[model samples]
Target: MDTRRLTQYVICVCVILTTVTLAQGQIKRCFACRSRGALGDCKDPFRFNSTHLVPGVKDEPCASGWCSKRIEGKKDGKDHDLAIERQCLQRSPPDDKERCSEALVGHRKIFICFCYGDLCNSASGIKPSFLLLFIPLAFQMLSSRF
Candidate 1:
């Protein structure tokens, strides 16, 4: 094959491989769990250790490429309870970002966070380490061709 054609073929292959790798990276696995009160593993101060052994919490893929955690505080006449949820999102929220935001639902207060990293909706919040780790690998692959 001619030099020009060989170079073009290599570039094309690299592009295709990169695209596939990036697409795979977009799908994230997040923790899915919910608890209506403070008695479950899904509640605040979530234990990150040995989560796989937990009965209610499991990892699920997020097709929308986003994971979210919602915490709702409900109050009755003189008692208060907390509802915690962590799951993979099917659709992106309007204010989808890597930060947590608060809102009022009736008399209850809710704090929801949307993130795009694997298991990012954990108790510690967003995890950008995945992207941070990918950038250098991608750059190395591209640079090695030169």
Candidate 2:
């Protein structure tokens, strides 16, 4: 191949490789579960379970997933609750908690915390500290490239 053609081919290959790597990296696969029935129902509203969906296998797509829910109520003369509804959501809820109101599920006071990232809805629930750390790194990468 001529010099110009050869240079173009190398650039194309690099671009393809980088695109594939970045695409794979962005697919935030998280532990999939729900607090319904026998799924991930929190029997103890104050505690969180660490049950993940297959340790190393990224089974589900979590592009915009979050996992934070707590529901408490009384049943059968005992206090029943569901702590962390650890799972993945296809898209985020439409309203923020401030604007999002609560509802009564048969005397259960359900509290939901919406956040973003892989398994980020855990106890921490999308920490600003992480965003603070991520912003500078992203800025440096983009600025350095320019």
Candidate 3:
């Protein structure tokens, strides 16, 4: 092949390879989504919360397919639980605690200090607002003793 033609061919091949790599990188998924037939009841209301469908896939790119729950899984006036976050979706029924626990499983990938309900205790470090709320009560107790 001529030098000019060979250079063009090389450029075209590089472009194709870059495009494929970029496309694959765009398909990342959340760490919580579980396998269920077509989102099942594992979804959230779009108007109130941002949702990630097919959440727990390992290297899938995140995509926006959110809708305002055009349908309901109501059973006797109660909404159906969508297993959109973690294995809670695959649960049989009436296992609310399991769902909650899974939801709070924390990013094990994050530091252990931040994993799951670490903020539940006083030792987690108090917010100034919360300490402010107790100031009045402390003052009242001191005044009563006086």
Candidate 4:
């Protein structure tokens, strides 16, 4: 390739990469439920009463973390205790499972766990968030080369 064409190609690749990186750093989604009725009512297969789109923290990437908290306790004295509260946390530890879990603990009779990924704590299953992003990114990368 000629010098000018090569420079253009490099610039194009850089732009594409930058765009993808920025996009990946934003737009995280998590299931949210704060109401007692929603927690008990949205059952069978389990459904989130709603979802939370996390906002970007100052000096941090927007929506880069997904967090869910399930508060488990016993209504009566039985082993069948269930999660009484479930919510999507606004700010969460990023990419650190241990830290997330640790942060969720310290409540009596309440079992809490945190995970990274959209709807990861749902009864259905975890949704593959990266696949959606990568499909378009791969296409862009492939298309740009030609």
User: Considering every candidate listed, which one attains the maximal lDDT?
Assistant: 1
Best by TM-score: 1
**For each candidate, what is the lDDT?**
0.73, 0.48, 0.31, 0.50
Residue pairs in candidate 2 whose N, alpha carbon or C atoms collide under 3 angstroms: 42-81, 42-82
* Model 4 ranges off by over 4 Å: 1-25, 35-39, 42-44, 48-64, 75-83, 93-95, 98-107, 129-146
Instruction: State the displacement of the C-alpha of residue 64, model 4, in Å, after optimal TM-score superposition.
Output: 5.9
Give the per-residue lDDT of model 1 (tens digit) for 14-47.
6666677677677778889988764778876777
Reference-based lDDT, residue 7, model 2 = 55
Off by over 4 Å in 1: 1-24, 49-51, 74-80, 125-146
TM-score for each prediction?
Answer: 0.60, 0.41, 0.26, 0.44
Model 3 stretches astray by more than 4 angstroms: 30-146
Q: Which portions of model 2 miss their true places by more than 4 Å? A: 1-25, 33-60, 74-83, 96-102, 125-146
TM-score of 1: 0.60
Ranking by lDDT: 1, 4, 2, 3
Q: Give the lDDT of residue 45 in candidate 3.
A: 32
lDDT of 2 by residue, 1-146 (tens): 76566556655655666576566557665544444432343333323323443332223557665444443443435333433344566666766332223567676676555555555544543334333455455445445544
